[model samples]
Target chain A: MSVKNLEELNPIQIDVLREIGNIGSGNAATSLSGMLSNTIDIGVPVVKTLEYEEVVDFLGGPENVVIGLLIRLSGDIKGMMMYILQSSFANVVLNTFYGKQLDDILNVDEMDKSAISEIGNIMAGSYVNAIAGLTGLTIDISPPSFCVDMVGAILSVPAIEFAQVGDRVIFIDDNFKISNDEIKSNMILIPEMESLSLLFNKLGVEI
Target chain B: MSKVINVGIADLNVALAPDILATYALGSCVGICLFDKTKSIGGLAHIMLPLSTEAANPSENKRRYADTGIAELLALMKSKGANIQAVVAKIAGGAQMFATNSSVFNIGERNVNAVKKVLESYKIPIIAEQTGENYGRTVFFDSSTGLMQVKSASKNIIVV
Candidate 1:
């Protein structure tokens, strides 16, 4: 069977998808709180079904230099999960991990890089587990890779894959909020179109 | 201000001298720019996949694939009175934004290789290239001088 575009999903189906995204982000927020040893809250998850080009603008613009971490998932369901912290918030995360003031510049060292990788791994791991638990599907994630790049470049990871079928893509926008700090982080999940259907079917959401 | 033309993903366009052709946030996609020095006309394509045959079904946007997009770019330039034989290529983007252990996410490398192969087949010499790194680049092609300005946060403006 051919894949269905995100536009084809009904409003009810979209709500169901948004709830799933909420659960995933809830799990990820827990992990972040534990990692930083401080309370972290997540804002309402924004779910959008957009074309590839619009997705590029979701993180402000294609040229916004942001710190991004990516993980590819397989097994019962396949997709790509990403964690993004703008350079400003990334410094806050680093300072929290290091327990000291880092330079004003965003200079991430080896340890800092690994911390970012860990962030990706933990967030994606929890998100996939949330889906797996909800739908009773087995899921496996690949090793995490971290890089500092423009939002456009990071998003292109999933964009290239989805392009094979069509221009449509499912975007799960999760915003991270840390207590007492002006910090912002974004977690975007792009699920494969086929796997998305399987998820919706298992959850009994009418499409 | 020089007029700048925007190129979309899987879409190709051409412009004349003193006009700039630009594409944004090229991560895995290759921006292929071909310019005729004498006529001062150039074209650019933001290609996603490496080959059309690799797609399960034929994509409606032929410019989405490397092989077809390059050919279309040449054809577009030719229609505008640009000499195809005199056109030289300068390219940017084709970066592995993330390091995935699995080969499925290695589309960036495949895209770079496919773009090079396509150019080679067309007998177009590549004058300069900035590809296969872990950074996203926005490239602007100046048809006036055939110089491509590659901009990224991590580096200086790469001119080719």
Candidate 2:
């Protein structure tokens, strides 16, 4: 009746998690659209079970540099959420909000860091709010932490944290599009196993 | 005419002469490279955690921790005709990529310290190291030359 590892989840359980991803990402997309005043399109969220080795390539490539915002979730859901953006897309946001353009993601200043962190916080809040409303679970999120590094390295944080429970992480992946630019941004939600079970119980799903 | 062998996270491999052993995007994970120049042999291990003793499951992959991963790497290199006595190590990619208030996330520093302890116990001198920064690193170890090239996004490539 309980699922300890990602591989133990059946198809029905997977579908339920996918539905949660859909609702959460839908709310995130709406909030992002309102912030930029642009129409946003979100792809159907996918729940993928990946090994730690494959986590790097899940974004794009291991060596590819990216801007990552990590938010830790507590209370009902204990896990991490990552907002990953490419350099070009980050530059677009910076230019749109502060009229500042960044030549490189690694060259981000403190002000730019704060801007990106705030954006991540808003998007994560929207997502958590939607999930909490649906499941009636009390969830609290920490302030977003910003980092610009290789996507492989950035994703390693979650991979290491969750490796003890299982060799694989079942993460929800959401892709977003703004205007005509099909920027490849990913929103990754990695809820802990206990939190996952709690979420499923709240949703009236048998794991 | 040398090929680059990619070592993924929680993995380890040994290479012959003229070939390069590479592990990409090492954040908190430590990539330990052991090179025997005389025989032109190199081995690399990309480890995520500090110790295997603290692992929740004993059946987990040995290459996921510094203590066991480095030991496995050395044993594999010796099997590949490497002189264990002549082997020196070059380590990179133990970085605190993000600033967090919680010390629980300070795994990067702990991993680096664990790697040092393992290598020292094995009597393998760490000739060069690039660690404890706020960025990710991709490392390439040349077996023929016993040189490790450390590359970062914002910094120039350095051969250690």
Candidate 3:
């Protein structure tokens, strides 16, 4: 972990990060498509090194209710990963992931919860696997822990983590759309401050 | 005049009688509310970290940590003429949000413990609390009655 602030990343550096995201999210998207048996497409990720406070705005306001899947990345890099979907997407998730009847979004049973968590687990595994394969860094991810709560609350976990060391946070967001073009899920990867330097170093980008 | 003011993450605010101080989506963080029973003045702080040690050197925000945030909250209420000595606290939040064994950086527990220590050192008694669950909370502290109404994400509502 590098103990320095990244006020900005050069275009080349951003490009490198983008490629990393592209590879990782791309692999995850393929597996997700296979698991859901539906067409799932991911757009090019938007990478940003933002202030700790600014990151929560993308989650549709801190107070907006969201269903989130969280995991911890250990091994060579330590950080947090979250997959959040709007309630509007709950039916699709349940229909496609668990083959369960789509009813009221609020009627999520323990099985539905487990299914959502399993999806998160798979996505996390696929994401880290791709990053490791590309960067040659060892990555270990924990099982998915699920939560349904306010976006602000879910994001507070990472926000406070980065705030502890500094005010800068680096992350990538890949918007995934379902068959109908409605964005059903937002994939986020919060690489630790140290891990950013490690990745950049591997790419030969100076801090 | 019923007033409800929202305090953002790592922030603090104060209100007078018939007014309320509130904060939303507190997960793995602590909300400290101090009320002066005699003056009917209240202050609330949403602190994110346990100690200032974790704050970056030359910390620009003292209200973001428990050690500094609690003291600053008391000073703010006192500045408004609310006697710190007469202040009794009703605290909430400090939820884990997810189960993990890492007490080292288990920020929710740390924040809860830190807030308690700080308030104790200041000789303020904690009269009520709602904390340490795996759910986010929306808390409303009514200065008029020194009452805190807590609404959990899981749909549990209670007063403390």
| lDDT (tens digit, per residue) of candidate 3 on B50-120 | 88965546367998889899888888998999988799988888888776667776888888998999899
For each candidate, the alpha-carbon lDDT, in order, equals 0.81, 0.85, 0.79
TM-score of predicted structure 1: 0.91
Worst 10-residue lDDT window, candidate 1 chain B: B96-105
Over 4 Å off, model 1:
A1-3, A100-106, B101-105
How well does each candidate superpose onto the true structure, as a TM-score? Answer: 0.91, 0.95, 0.89
The order of the candidates by lDDT, greatest first, is: 2, 1, 3
Residue A154's lDDT within candidate 2 is 88
Model 2 quality (TM-score): 0.95
Error of 2 at A154 (Å): 0.7
Q: How well is candidate 2 docked (DockQ)?
A: 0.77
The 10 consecutive residues of candidate 2 chain A with the worst lDDT sum are A47-56
Q: Per-residue lDDT of A50-74 in model 2, one digit per residue for the tens?
A: 7655666777798888888999999
Estimate, for each residue in B34-80, the C-alpha lDDT of model 1 and write its tens digit.
99999999899999899887778867889888999998889889999
